[model samples]
Target: MRRRGMTRRSLVASAAGLVAAMGTGGDAAAARTARSVRGGAGGESVRNGGDESVRGGGGGEDRFARGEMRGVWVASVANLDWPSRPGLTAAAQRAELIAHLDRAVGLRLNAVVLQVRPTADALWPSPYEPWADCLTGVQGKDPGWDPLATAVREAHDRGLELHAWFNPYRVANHTDPARLAASHPARLHPEWVLPYGGKLYYNPGLPEVRRFVQDAMLDAVRRYAIDAVHWDDYFYPYPVAGQVFEDDAAYARYGSGFPDRAAWRRDNVDRLVREMGERIRETRQGVRFGISPFAVWRNAATDPLGSDTRAGVETYDDLHADTRKWVKEGWIDYICPQIYWHIGQSAADYAKVLAWWNATVRGTGVCLYVGEALYKAGDPAQPAAWQDPAELSRHLTLARDHEEAAGHVFFSAKHVAADRIGAMARVVADHYQDRARAPR
Candidate 1:
């Protein structure tokens, strides 16, 4: 999701307002509470169990009752969270990153999912792709320091897990290939790129493109000590009105045996997930792989196994990501569904979606960490529920009712720091009373 145009000053002001709303003794009390929660919540140890197939149904042991996956996404795309904006000095950028890590530690959070490869570009020196434009405002120009490497080291030192987030197919926000760095893989191999819905994406249907993207992402896995490799819900771009993905050629070439184009597309994504999981294991054991997909898989009206929601987009039908299937098949280590809604909304109730996911991963050993919309907490355009400071905290309380709910990861770091309307602060007061370790 795109970030709101809230300024840093405004975010700080809102955080102050939150403190006032909390009626705390002041910053000192808050700091004390944060420190107190740093202790681990005792329970079963959940670690990466390799690629073992996790099977069963809703009735099974809750393996992650005490563990948690508290994380915040440090988005680099469009400079939503980190770097403040493009073109900052390398020292300034490093300071900004350190501030974010410090903020996580103060909040008693245990993980930071930093977007190292925002748009098929590298935050580190990758032989496969150019430097990310978000680093220096010049796609191919090095920012003079290694962001992924520094992030991993600093995070581990702070006792926070650093998950390297990557967007596999997105090439650029714009459609102009000439605007990209000359060394950009998308520009060099034009046939592998597709301009769709005003953005450029590497064609997922091509075998070579799939393999190349994996190699590019794995380059970081091979270099850094990142706790996990995370992907957002951008597998196939969300459907645009009246526009088509225009993968006719790739489909025709590789879609021979599949019954239809939709099935073929799903298979393409499945291969990417399954193959990436295998390759990640081959590259580094104990390095987890996870996807934070759009909440709804399918509406019950669409399928019997689907959630009881009327979401506009279904990951199965629109994005072609069989997220539920991935969990059942044990292709990935964990599943964080972006249930970005309120407790009792009409379309996709946060509780309902959480319950659906809780059931989906019950018997499967895949951990369930709810993806929260902290960005929506005080968004004026959001429903009234989000305006209430207690909305997000209520979500955590509701999630506590579910046996399979391991933890939660907020949308982007800005909102967590923003604490707009004090929602995030309220969440900490209500639910994050105890510091928890990230589930394996």
Candidate 2:
């Protein structure tokens, strides 16, 4: 992405706000400095550094505060991020994993959201699901060692928290399950899944389906030493333009009190999220529960209290995800909004959404971590804001204004590995160079 350089007019406009606040008094000046530092769209460490250096704060092990979380997503589907070249020897896989962890350790990041079960498959040994095809050339053929166990063991060795990322409702991503290995879950339990929007997803409205997904996922949580349980933005599969999610039968049978099909669909997800949180605590108290939902929940046009964006599809209306409700109700430990846009874009402005999220997370203990769009930072089609090396830098700086904004987690690991436009160097040199805050 080719971003525009910071304009003098924009800088002056930003300074004007700071100056107005500072003119009040010494206390106001300190607050203004903190706000100005927080208001920039820079990296978190750089923004936090201004706060620390300005206040003449001391640094030590004390800098690593308790209850802080920072991580990157390790996607397995299509080999999107890690395990760079697929079908590499087991030794190569292990080596690549170590290198990724080394970067995270060097950056002082505390967590790795590795995709163990990208689809309805296994990254570790399981009787219920077959081995992930993304791992080995063919499905059901093991890639050698149990990936989850190896990932957990290796991550712990380097003092990094490993979160087992799971796609709760997704089955065969795009291809038909008849094309899948005979032993794949979708083939074995065709009745449990429904094909929708050119992809197969476990019928969310079915109780048996819900229980099965939880059982398949919780098995890993109980067996592995994972530090957190993570689910991403694919809650009911982002709505297809014209096609509807084929869950009519599941809802007709399951829906009793719900008035409409939409409400029933949302309740199914609510059940899964609420029940999953309770179950995680029941199984592993220390393992956190987090969801990175779509950036906009709803636009103010739809709801009076919604965000000021004109996003056509929102998590609340289109995807049946009450993301803000979950955070307000304390159903999740952390909320990572995929605020992947520029400063003044018409749809889903990054800065506006970040402020909305910070304000929404006011009373709840839920932590807010802006999910960086690392992939777009160098892509040609991305907005002008992403091209600037300092675009993401300014984002993190802006987020620091919120006390609840604990830290940041970029989308995937490989993009940063490329060091596109020196984005990685800027982050490490500026902030993560120091010791990280301790785990909660």
Candidate 3:
């Protein structure tokens, strides 16, 4: 893929409307968040950092209920939901973040899974790679402030846990390296990347590649006040239509005693997860580690222990992410499967997967937080289960039904902003109205 050239004016025009909708830019709340910073402990505050005075009636009633790991993903690629556009000014960017936090606090969300390294870049000051293109027009141009630092401080003032979400293997959303800045990791170390599925990714099969990615992400955990090291579902890129992953070279070089390539890839990810978990726990004893894997582990026909779904792509067979293994072995602190499908859909049924995950994670000492499909909550084009106003609420109901299922995190932040299904409003009014103390 060739690099697409863009001018700053074009980016400004593209994002102007988005910036306007982010409200009057800043308010007294924004000023409070700004003033909340005070360089004290663990880079910032612990999770669910909210006001101590505003006590409501609902939180205590739900104390017997499983405490949720509520959060929303703040995606930066293509400027999906944050920074408005590619070249937002640093002030505008900070304002946008404040608005996001305000929404998070308003909805009574316990955490914010902000994307720190969406691709092989940084949202804050970093010595390893350049600034994210999503922050400024130019990739390496400094945004004049540390977004991670400010976010940590402000989020803590409001008492929200900030999990620095990292895309472990994703290098770029596009396939062009020349488009990236000269200092971009892909440009600096071209051999470490492999272009596939219309995007570039660090080859998960290589030992050095695995170590490099782990170290780069762990560097953030070590340096910042990140409450957790969170990873999304980009393990071995979700299968391309007809193309095969181009990792034969690494497999040939490193697959020396493994049974096959599949096992080797699983080993590579497993190694990354285990080592990263151990490293984070060692560096920050309170930092939690979690993974949001694709919903189904495997079909029951494929494996007797797997969920009863007909999904074409299973986490184990296709992505090589043995998520069940992670839960069973107690490697992850929590497991959030993206149960995006409806109740009775045959492809990947939500109820079946939830039951399976709930049963599997009951006593493993790993918390289970179902990843609700907020985007599908009330879409008329979707199945009847989705169109129901209580669709997501029903999922939350299912979460409540489970022994180990604690809480949920919506897919993207923008969805919660829409008030679709009225689920966010419902949770706040009914369950999370008061500030429940943080989990011990």
TM-score of each: 0.86, 0.84, 0.85
Per-residue lDDT for 1-440 in model 2, tens only?
A: 00023332443345455545546543433332232222222221111211221110122233323324557888888788756756888888888888888888777677788988877887888877888888776778888987788888877777677878898988876858876779877787788888888888888888988988888999987787677788888878787778877777887788989988888888889989999988987886567778888889999899977999999888987889989888866677678888888777787888889889888875454667778887788788887877877777676666655555656778789986786887756766655555563234
In the range 1-440, model 1's lDDT, one tens digit per residue, is 00123332443444355446657644533332222122112111122223121111121222233346779999999999998998999999999999999998777778899999999999999999999999899999989999988998888777788889999999999999999999998888999999889999999999999999999999998887777899999998989998889899999899999999999999999999999989987887668789999999999999999999999999999999999999877677778999999988999998889989988876444667899999998899999998999988888777767767767899889888888799878877766655555654
Name model 2 segments beyond 4 Å from true. Answer: 1-67
lDDT of 3 by residue, 1-440 (tens): 00013232332333344334446652322221121111113434464544432222332343332234667888877787788797777899999899998998877776888898888888887777788889887888898999998888888878888878888888888899998889887788888889988999988887888888887887788788877778888899899898889888898899989999999999988988888877876777667788988898899989999988888899898999999988766677777889998777877778888999988875354667778788776777878777776667666665655656667788788778887778667656665656543322
Candidates in descending TM-score order: 1, 3, 2
Backbone clash count, each prediction separately:
2, 18, 6
Candidate 3 structure, TM-score to reference: 0.85
Report model 1's TM-score to 2 decimal places: 0.86
User: Model 3, which residues run further than 4 Å from truth?
Assistant: 1-66, 437-440
Ranking by lDDT: 1, 3, 2
Q: What is the lDDT of residue 256 in candidate 1?
A: 99
Report the C-alpha displacement of residue 313, candidate 3, in angstroms.
1.1
Model 1: lDDT equals 0.81
